[model samples]
Target: MSNTDHLTALKDKIQAVEDGSIVAITMPVNIYLQEAEDMARCARIDIAELATINVTEVQIDDLQARIGACREVQSLWVEDQHKANQAEDLWADIQVQANELKSELIHTFRYAYRKDEHLMSAIADIAEGSTNSDTIQDLNDLSVLGKGNTDALTAINFDLTKLDTAADIAVNGADALAVANGSRQRGSDTKVLRDKAYTYLKESVDDIRAAGKFLFRNEPKKLKGYTSKYWKKRNQSVKKESDVESEI
Candidate 1:
């Protein structure tokens, strides 16, 4: 194929892989495997065409040997895929256990103390406006992308660690507030509990924002509203400073 034709064909292949068509139990995994297979077939075809284009026998043999080496790597990838599937299954099971525990705790203790009406209300308010759900979803994304380059993955892991710590602190603070308000009236440690909750809530928000800023810093277009504007301006200023420094 001509260069333009090859480019168009590659684009078509990429689109087909990205189309999200459901041909199996899981669309993404199947699509990725199919894409790999297609690319390997294309490589074989290209090798055959090269052999027919007046290439030396030695060159063809070298190409064939390289293909064999790649096939060996592909076999190693199959082993990696099997291990990844096991890890994913284990993670799913952990999620189920965690969800069960969360449900049981809420059901068994949320309303056990009738005098904890104010405490329960505080918890509800916190839950209603919480960024914990988004934080969790981002963490899942980070985990799934863990196989990327070591430096990039390490940066993501660091941000996730910060987020996890902040989330834990917020959760612990909420639990403490709940315990404090469970027994005492408004005249007791109510203010203390409120202050604790507020401090943790603010910390959670700050940490979450920091994580998001780092996560999408390279793709400011993906950010929304104030975040998009802020990052865009920040990126432009940094670029300008770097350019001036280089000129100096």
Candidate 2:
């Protein structure tokens, strides 16, 4: 698909949230990844240049030494092999740094893309609305806008409260939505209120997932892997519980 089409599809997928009214939302992860790829490509090019320099420096050093060692030396060719060695060392260091950067870029891409998938799924869920009739009835009952003798003013106030709470959480959370906003104030800005609301919904999905993991920790279905630094720090209670159980 064309780039425009791809972006449109992505937007459509996200916009499905809240009966397609959440069109203001943008995926910060995707945006950041695109910029990161550009930066990584540039760094790779620089590394390639360093590699070339290393080869040229070594070759030139060897040529100069060969000529200097020749007899009938009227002109002295002072070959600074030390300088060439230093250049080789620097080039090796640059290659190592570049490789590390590339690995980091790959890891970041995987993480961000996974997050994007989750957000898209959440958006789809919100779009589908309530599937169960009983749940739908209950939601309609609790909805401030529904037929419960609630006037438009009251409904608007309730929505404002929900939106405000969501915005506050999104702004404080590590989700790319807030990061994409460039500044915290932008999240609260009138121009991006809808966008903030969309991000809040996205964060709600994260909260749900975290809660599920906590609740299902004892189940055998729980997969083992490296925990994120943030989760490792925050999930101390789980670790403590596990340790206590192991002792028993």
Candidate 3:
């Protein structure tokens, strides 16, 4: 075939293989989704449990007791205001953690989807003979691209790690900003710390994006059959069977 014809033929083969791989990819995607959902649900349940315990209730009660002991209403009001401020601070910290977990869940889903796409593309290239066969000796080779225990597992662990790191940075940066804002209201020195925290947050976001791009890069080869050896083995088996039948 001419080069153009060969490429066209290869494309057709690739399309067929891609169709098959898409079906295979679905199983892994579902598995990853289930695992991610379970994890997110567990985290939310834990947070809810903590909230139910009403640990903050103790602090509020302590504040009330102190207020009752004060002779002046003004002094009681000041204590109450301080306690309210502390409660607000605690709530903000919880909010940051919740947001971080939400971001992590999103990252997990995206990583799983991306992994599915990569596997499908790789399988297509292999079926089309467009990739180096040596690079993908079998399905095991394809599994290495994923983060699971076996080659068949398509979990993208590396992507998850990067996302978690980014989430931590974002949560910490937001907390720092809240602190700086509160400090400013009290006429305390905080501008320098705020600037530093913001810079770190920006760097963290950039790193996350870079890591995602690296993971999403295209594979150069695909997995293919060892047709020549397979055919040779088949012929040998056939010949042996024929000789045995003749002897009979």
TM-score rank order: 1, 3, 2
Candidates 1 and 3: which is better by lDDT? 1
Per-model TM-score on C-alpha atoms: 0.31, 0.17, 0.20
| lDDT (C-alpha) at residue 214 in model 1 | 49
RMSD of each: 27.4, 30.7, 37.7
Residue 191 error for model 2, in Å?
A: 13
lDDT scores for all predictions? 0.38, 0.34, 0.36
Number of the top-ranking candidate, with TM-score as the measure: 1
Of 2 and 3, the candidate ranking higher by lDDT: 3
lDDT of candidate 1 over 1-248, digit per residue (tens): 33233233333332333223312222232233333334334334344433444434444333333333323333434555555555545444544543443343233333442246754564344334323342333333223332232353253343434334334443543444344333333323333322222232223233333444444456554323114234356689999999999999
By TM-score, is 2 or 3 better?
3
Query: What would the per-residue lDDT of candidate 3 be over residues 1-248, giving only the tens digit for each residue?
Result: 33233233333332333222322122232232233333233323333332444323333332222222211222333445565567557646655644444444333444454457765565454334322122223222223333332223233443434434444444554555455455445422222222222232223223322332333234212111101233356689999999999999
Q: Report the poorest 10 consecutive residues by lDDT, candidate 3.
A: 219-228
